[model samples]
Target: MTQNERIFLPWWKRVVIVIATVIVFALQIMLFVFAFQVNFDFPFNVWIYWIIEGGSFVLVYHIIHRPILTNYKLTWSILILIFPLPFSLLYYLNQRSLALPKYKQKKIDTILGNYYNPNQIDCTLELDRKDPKAAKLARILRSSTGYPLWKNTKYTFLFDGLLKHEDMLVELKKATRYIFIECFIISDGKLLSELLPILKEKGDAGVEIKIIYDDLGSKATLKKKTILEIAQIKNCTFTNYNPLGLNINPAFNYRDHRKMVIIDGKTAYCGGDNLADEYIHQKKRFGFWRDNCGKYEGEAVQSFIALFIEMWYISTKMVLKLENYLCDYVLERETSYILPFGDGPSNGAEPGYDIFRSLISSADQTLYISTPYLIIDEAMIESIVLAAKSGVDVRILMPGIPDKKVAWYLGRFHYKDILLAGGKIYEYTPGFNHAKNIIVDGRYAFIGTINMDYRSLFLHYECGALILLDNEIYKMKDDFLKACDDSKPITYEDWKKRPWWQKLISYLLYLFAPLF
Candidate 1:
């Protein structure tokens, strides 16, 4: 079946499916309660009570001590306390890392060890001497992600999706050795139609092509024919990350949210645009789809190659030689320092969250952020509030036209706190602003696939590059300011005057923000 034809079900069928799912879920919950709470023979019942009481205590302790977000731990603790038996078992099951086996993890560590040992001590020391805040952020990112700070790197900010599409095609055609493309979503649309032919031609020409897309992310739009065509392409390997199944493991909650296009280990593209028609405006889902993408070369591209290698190993058990794909020559430009890094469930560290928090903490004059979702925890909110209260020009740009209403409402829930603390919030009046960007004092910038949501920060595999003291940061700042003019600002008065129904909806959704 064609992608457009098979992607959506009829209204009646969808309704039936929804009803069936709800019924089955309710029945399962009922059976679970009955199985757990029902009284048994005297001795057996006593033993069951002891096990439940003891296990609940231990699980609660472990949950509290887990190195996750404070809000996340609190929510899970409340759920466990309420449903001690089922939630305890569920927590244990969710903690298991079924997606990453021991060998694959060891392989990732082995691959990262090569790049981590040779930390750019000179670049770090120079940053420390010049700007201690930037130095501290760089040190934390390097230590957490094992991707060292790099100098002599070229960075280009692609503010428009169409520009990114054009630039990506040019880079793909120049690939003489290999191409690595990974995205959260890769649908069969105008974008993919234009892209697949080039990839197929390149693969036939002996340029190795590797592609990874999250199965759940693309399940609706990726056609069977598209998968087969990719499989049949010569010298091309397509692997889906974390296939959705009937398993009850927590891996199901995680996704490969990283997006990038790397060619010959010499050039790379990373940002928010996915391989979809809506992303580039061939077909618009929510008015004008405002997004940002970036193209870069030089030493930082090597780090992107390493991230691809690590994810490729996890998806396919075939290990790639780390040395085989690295760029041999450097561009030798002393413009700015860029550090490309990756984070996910493979390691317990929440580097994505840490990076965002650090950038927010280090903003001396101005902090500009653009994201599709603003679903963050209290700690991040505190950082934003602190920056605003300390007189930093903190501006956040969000989507006026939402693709997910619940998430949008949850985003609005935090507007009061920000506005009351002297921060400005703007919604892109033209359309859904899907770009994930952060510019600090026009001296530092972040451009990549990571969003300001819990999924992007805590649960998904994400990649991005931190640009420090670069001219590109000014471009990002300019773009952010121009976009802000196109957006509608939310003032304290406006927030207070919002509809009661909207406020209630946002309040209801706030409790589930972390999960979403």
Candidate 2:
């Protein structure tokens, strides 16, 4: 069956699309007639300009504005019709030429002013002296700008999605006050079904339950109405981030890719694993889908809760009670220091790329990295090369069988330079590996939605924790070693021996890497 047949569309959406198309067509016709009547000497070049300019405007308008339009439809429609063409043309050209103006930079700086903190270095040194593990973790966290520091926090790092799912279920069952879930892709599969009933029961018992899922991430997997219906039936609130529709903005590419769950403001989970059977290797199609996640308790959980609240408000227009959830719950038992960090497109000052770069720069012993995509920016590429050149052991594992062929090829484009610089590259031969993580110096580790790519760094919403404790770091290191065992190492000689056609394509993809 076709995708539309597989997932039903709302009747209202169909009516709105029809009306929008008519309006757009009418506006174009009116503009053409007015321009002709107003100026009898209108040149052929001017007419061609109108056709090209006006047509481009209509296409973008249809694609962006077609999605969710409730109270802001009229206002948004006016803005799209009046502004998008000229604005988009300018934006597209400037971005293409890498010539963004100073004002844009200032605007970005203003947005990200809160992302950086110079005091983190002192905190890292202090934590290291008091608890070596905390210090190491602090160093990693400090590497990334905008990552907040927490005084008292507990962290549990899971090796794979199996452990993550089991632990998440346990936490969900014990949730007493509230549960907030935000994920880029949430499939209605075994993992979700297991907790659905529990979430429903908790919601019925007066617990506040809220969820946000990205529309594009869940597209063709779950119907919007099905999600809304389930939310209503369970008395839980649900919102979709960046729903795709005609007349939608181009900024739809900036998606909420974070996968996090905060329970009662006491415990939280964040990592690369999504709420799907495939993530846990429960499905037969993808064999051994290895992934990782980190669980946080105490003060660190508060940061995650705050991140969830921010996203919830952005998606649902609901201001959550942050003060109530910010209570410090100190643990008597000794636990490693942890810091929860969040990143996104709006992260003007604390761009996730800078965080990843900082982590790469501070490597002492070894840096073991795992990610699905590797379309890295120039700075990240230089950092990895410099680290390897400086005698810091750097090993990276990418997918052998990628879900996106273009991304896989683009990932290989860096293999030659990485290997030449003394870095080791491995490709997991056993199906797709979707985990995004980095463990530095076998002391500091990070697991989150952010990939070592431009999309995750500057576009998508991402989150992860800077884990300092030795136990978690060791576990992540072991996981990386285990993954290496299942991977085939790509050497400099191997990359140099690539077929002529493959090399040509890889070179082309590399040129367009920034755009991707």
Candidate 3:
């Protein structure tokens, strides 16, 4: 729904926030200068100073109390110990900006809660009869994560953005009730230029259309005038998520890194490909930009709609009823199960990371993964190593052509360790592989927008679909096998001689990974 009034900070609150932020940062600089640059001799025993010494104690207490990643905790501890007041000021600001108010998060959850309520499937007996091990994995998914395994949901695995581009248009032309598009990035490029006309025509046909894009994600490509014009379209609504401003807020780190398209609540698409030229290879950036997109047709699309409604509420504060957009279309039971789920910085559960860990730990025969970036933490490393060491055929495919050099090196940082543990690593020799997919024992297929990096796991909103016992699982496995032919294998011997300087750089970058 479109509205004239926005749920936003009043002008006075905005002024206060800006002024306070400026004063805090200025004081931080002054403290840094005073502590290191200008040493004064007016002190009688520095340890006797109550405020500084007490603040040091307070920093220690904060470090102990803050529920942050261990690596980040250690890194922050080093900074706070070295520069107490400045780092403490930064810490306060970071927390202030990063944490969404509890009431707002609760409101968002309350609106979308029922859709995510746990409901077990009765077909587990059947699943168990066929494959007991996969059934066990299914139980873990439903018990640990709230998403229930659903039947009669159909899935379309679009291997690349080019393929997704062709199929998405076919589905868009059939939208009867409404259209919702949310993306991490929506740049002015070949993709949008081609899709906007279709959206405009649908809007003209009295279809309710809404577009939500990440502010930072599309900042470089989408212009304000473009958003205004889109809003002017008939029955069209638009909002930029976590819109940019001049204020120094901690929220800058938390992003909407999800990409999905929900049409009439009957079909939904989710994957790593953003609406940019490079993603579809319209305007190539790093050779061939290979990515994946998956479309769900049936009841599972409801989860994606709920996710969109949550973000729409968070951004516009508009009241939305889930049932109005939900389609009651049912499909024949072809796939064993399809559970669409989301994860974010919010409390309670992190479905994306939890499921990934569960799959890695639960695999019996083989494990395969493809991702754009591989900036994992300790827990993930342990899982991969343990799985490989246990004789599970573990293999990971990475991009040979780099998009961000630092992220590539960070992935390489784990090469020696993972290779030594019997894990096989391959780099796609053709170009960048932005596809994020994981297959285990050819029984489960996970395809979505999540990348194997710190940002996607810990700092951003992400979503994916887990396909179980589907014929597409075999297709996913076959795709991996085909990719292997075009990929270059990296063995322990190959990693052993890579420049020591590069390893050192990756380690240093990895230390501050949580910040990125």
Candidate 4:
């Protein structure tokens, strides 16, 4: 029924596909049957049990050796005990492939280091003169990840996805040379209908365009033909970040979750909104669709440009010179400091999580957050509780109507302790809230794609903007306060009063949340 092209498979291709499917199913069944043999009392069963145990031990050794979070290692080790063969195979598959290919890493480091002009000296002096705490954080970020403190960057905080789309269009229209877009999801609907026209107009006018979308994230909404059509546009190239295919590889879990738009390497946008109708409430599925994004201009755009280039090279195997794309025009001076940072398989240091941890550690008056998921690691739990117990007002705004129910219930298991430690948890009464936001003391703000969860912080590629002394910081704080006013707050007593069955299920879900 759709106007798009459809593929009619040939007999040979169909036969190959059928053969692959049958083989995969057969392998899975064999694994299950062999696993079942551990319960039998034959000599062959003894050999099977020992073989699986030996494989699990080998996997446990590697898991212990991996420089991952202690909680993650512990979870995998426990799973290895319960289902030795499958869990061990999972560990063996995941641990080895978590790091990017050597050639890809080399390419990223070369582009990230050589082409980036962080403007560090001037930023360090500015930090020392104005905010000492921010200066310490800048040092931590710089050492951990080379993202430098940017000066004179103007920030526009868009609390709604529609508003962000408005600004994005304005910026997209102004692009004379290049436009780079990377996102987790893209669907054909109101937002894409509006966006494709602009991108087409630009591409026809000789502007270069590049795009990368996560394959698994946009599986249903984006068809392969749509990408092919876009690739045919002049100077336009596009690729799926990680192609989801028939192979049963654990590496698919490490997705590109970052949503970044860079126009001419001068203006950039990063936030929670993806290219979907729900983000803008065009045709809402869950009630009122709440989201947020930040538009940045000036020196901070360089970091975003660098991020796009890194991804573009990885996906397309084509690297462009950063100097050619630098914003040639000077930006208006502003008083705020901005640092655009990214986290991914490219580095061992989790820059996104570390930034949030620093923000929590630095909170003086208030620590506010909004995220769809509340899956936090042990270190983050300690940070939140410690911050609240130290007398800071820690308030978190999570979604009421969840996209995933099991994880939503599991999130409640974490609420009891934080509520006791002077933390407040509120659920949006209207619908889903997909904003990844954090504000510290109404003076500093962080808004971007870094969700406060295990999958986002540890596994997926992510990006965020660190705002200091920006007037928009107050706006960020106000948005959270307004959400709180409209939401239902959960008390410690209420958290403790959850039914025993719910508690048991939540705890059960929580045990395996690290992998989620």
Candidate 5:
């Protein structure tokens, strides 16, 4: 079926596709096992079983000793122990693929050198003179991700995709040098319908345009013809990062979940909104779709430029001239630091997770978090609980209505703990709160696509901006407070009194939280 047809497929046809996909997936596993068994025919099968069993133990031991997260180790260990042959092989392959090949890494490192300035460390050093605690966090972010702390950057809070859509067009139309757009999902919807013409006009006018999206994430909504048309534009290039094929590997889970729109390296937008109709509320999949995106300027825009180029190199393996894209633009200066960084499973460091933990840990008076998915790990849970226990006014805002019921249920599983620890939990009554934001003591904020979930924190290629002492933070805080007003608070007593079935389901799902 054509891509457009897939989107408009009859319900029964879509159901058939889902069922067939599951069946094929199961068959693939079975065939893999069958092949393994057949390799050791007859009498040797018994010996091979013993060898496999021994190998499984060794793998389990290795997983335990690995310098990975506890949850990941548990998930892999359980799978390897339960299904030795396939899971063992899968684990081995996954470990081998976690890092980029030496040549690719060398090439990317070389590309990155074009953007780094040794003097930028002075930004962090200057921050130390103002707020030592914030400076410490900045140092950690710099050390872990190599993304510098940008000073005097202008930041704007686009409360929803509709607002972001307006700002994006304004910037896109003003593009003189180049435009880079990357999103997790880009569909044949109102957003894309509006964006393509501008891109075409600019591309034909000798302005470079680069676009990237996740193949699996957009396959259901983006048409093949749309992709072809985008590629056909003059001076335009498009990539569906980590394209799907018959090859089954852990790489499938590592999607490019980052979203950004950069114009001339002078301005950029990053946040939870994908290039879809629902994001801008042009087509309502749920109730009013609540989301956010931040428009950025100043030295910080350079970090976003570097981020796009990094992903571009990873996806296309052809590094564009860095000098061609990096533009040093002046900004209407604000006294805030913006650190734009990208994280992924391949990066060997969990900057997203670390930043979340750091933000939570640094909160003194108040901590407010907004995430569509609150399915977080134990470390995150402990940090929030500890903050609340230490007299911090911690409030977590989650979706009242869910796009994914299982994730919603899993999120509720931890509400009781936070509630008991004096942390407030609210469900947005208007609709899904799709924004991934964290505000600390009204002084620091994170506005980006890194959700408080395992997939975003540890698996996907995610990006976001960490803003320190930005005036826009008050705007974000006000929005959060207003959202809290529209939300329904969850009391510990009420949570304990939930339906038995929901409790049972949540508990069952909690066991597999890492995988989700």
Candidate 6:
């Protein structure tokens, strides 16, 4: 087996890790001394620095000496020989607090208790085929098993960013109740210029408007003053999600990476497109940045509204009343099946990863996935491998030129394993493919802001729709096939013959995949 296939750590590497732990502990002691010299006048600040530096020493010591420390005799010997009396007492207290078991609370069964009447809802689209592939694909568009979400909704697939911007502006102009907009990136571009004026106009006309955008995602593209000025002038509210700074929590890994617009809780717009010109090919970089988005009206619009409201509350710390925002103006349309689902780190019971896993396992005929970042975890990799082994045709499309070189190499590292398991991997030769989509068995399609990576699965906040047996599925499938025609396939033999230095770099990257 190759290094990537092995799960165990080598003995030499373990020894090196132990040596590094000792060095880290020594560095922490030096930091503590330096902090004391500079912070003697400020007792509180000195204590804080000591707590941080001393905690690092204790952590490193425990990690390095864990095996030996487990034995009572060796533990006593090391403690007596290593630490001064006061330091030993402090370490003992810290360890005891960490080990103590706190009170456990019983899980409350807060049953919203099936408030939905499935008989009253006609959202499921029946498929002609009874095969697993078809059923799995069909479920992508089906209403999730929770709360009868996305029922009685209308959907419009927007092909151009400019056109989408125009449609959104027109929708905002018609809003009579409320408006909620959430995005990962909102740049000062032609698209924003066209929509911002309309947003301000609606806000001034007594329409309730709320906006949430990621601070890091738009750091270089937007100015704080611009957004603040707009909020002040238009009587609108704006909040930045997870700002970037030295004191920011590492949990900033969980980002709001969705772009959505809901007008009056009746019409909603979502998909892979962000509020930028490049997404519409207006300001091209590597190539004409081809992308897709969807607009929905009907019951599914309610789900979109709920998602927006949930995010708004998290960002703004304000509770908005649904009755006040969603009353008589909701448009009732009859043609499409739309299921808008939000995925985030806080989804404890029904995680989006499980939903994705279910869809992949149910595929019996074919599965096609396109993603720019492909750093999938072991479970996802296993699903793809098993599907290929079961005689199901599985294909993935990745960019030939990557936005992140390390992630690109890590993805290439998996090509040999996938091909050996009977899957096909294609590279988009023209330029980067920023589209995140999956078309299963030609009957179900999923398009949204979630990438197939660790960040999207376990960290970042994301949202998307499952298009089951809808007209949009046909269009997405056709687009995928056309993309395949313009792509080059990678063979197992080709991958195995990659340069030794390239393989070594990819191997190192695989070790750090979890952090990425």
Residue lDDT tens for model 6, 97-134? 23212211010112122233353333333322323444
Weakest lDDT window of 10 consecutive positions for candidate 6: 103-112
lDDT of each: 0.83, 0.71, 0.78, 0.81, 0.83, 0.66
Stretches of candidate 4 exceeding 4 Å from the true structure: 1-45, 248-250
Cα lDDT for residue 226, candidate 4: 73
Clashing pairs in 5: none
Per-residue error for 216 in candidate 6, Å, reads: 1.2
lDDT of 3 by residue, 1-516 (tens): 011111133465446544644664466556645655344564443334436646865775576455555555555655665567787767665553254667788897688667643345556666777777667766665654455667777887777788998899999999889999999898886788889899999999999999889999999888778777788889999888888788766666678888999999889999988988898788867888888888888878887888888888877889689978887797887447787777775534456766787788877788999998888766677789999999999999999998998889888887777788999999998899899998998888789988888678766878888778888888888888788789999988888778888879887886566555
lDDT of 4 by residue, 1-516 (tens): 011111233365446545644664465457656766755666677566667766665776676566666556667866775577677767655553454777778877887667545468777887878888988777777777787788868889999999999889988998889999999998888888788888999999999998899988999988677777777877888889878777776667688999999898778999999999988888768778889999988888988888888878867788877777886657766577888888887776677777788899899989999998888875677789999999999999999888887878888888988998989999998999899998999888789998878888878888988888888889988888999999999998888888898899898777588877
TM-scores of the models, in the given order? Answer: 0.89, 0.76, 0.87, 0.89, 0.89, 0.74
User: Model 3, residue 416: what's the lDDT?
Assistant: 73
Candidate 2 residue spans exceeding 4 A from truth: 1-42, 46-125, 128-147, 333-335
Instruction: Sort by lDDT, best first.
Output: 5, 1, 4, 3, 2, 6
Worst 10 residues of 4 by lDDT: 1-10
Better model by TM-score: candidate 2 vs candidate 3? 3
Off by over 4 Å in 3: 1-53, 65-68, 89-98, 116-145
Instruction: Order the candidate numbers by TM-score, best to worst.
Output: 5, 4, 1, 3, 2, 6
lDDT at residue 307 of model 2 (Cα atoms): 75
Model 1, global lDDT: 0.83
lDDT of 1 at 286: 96
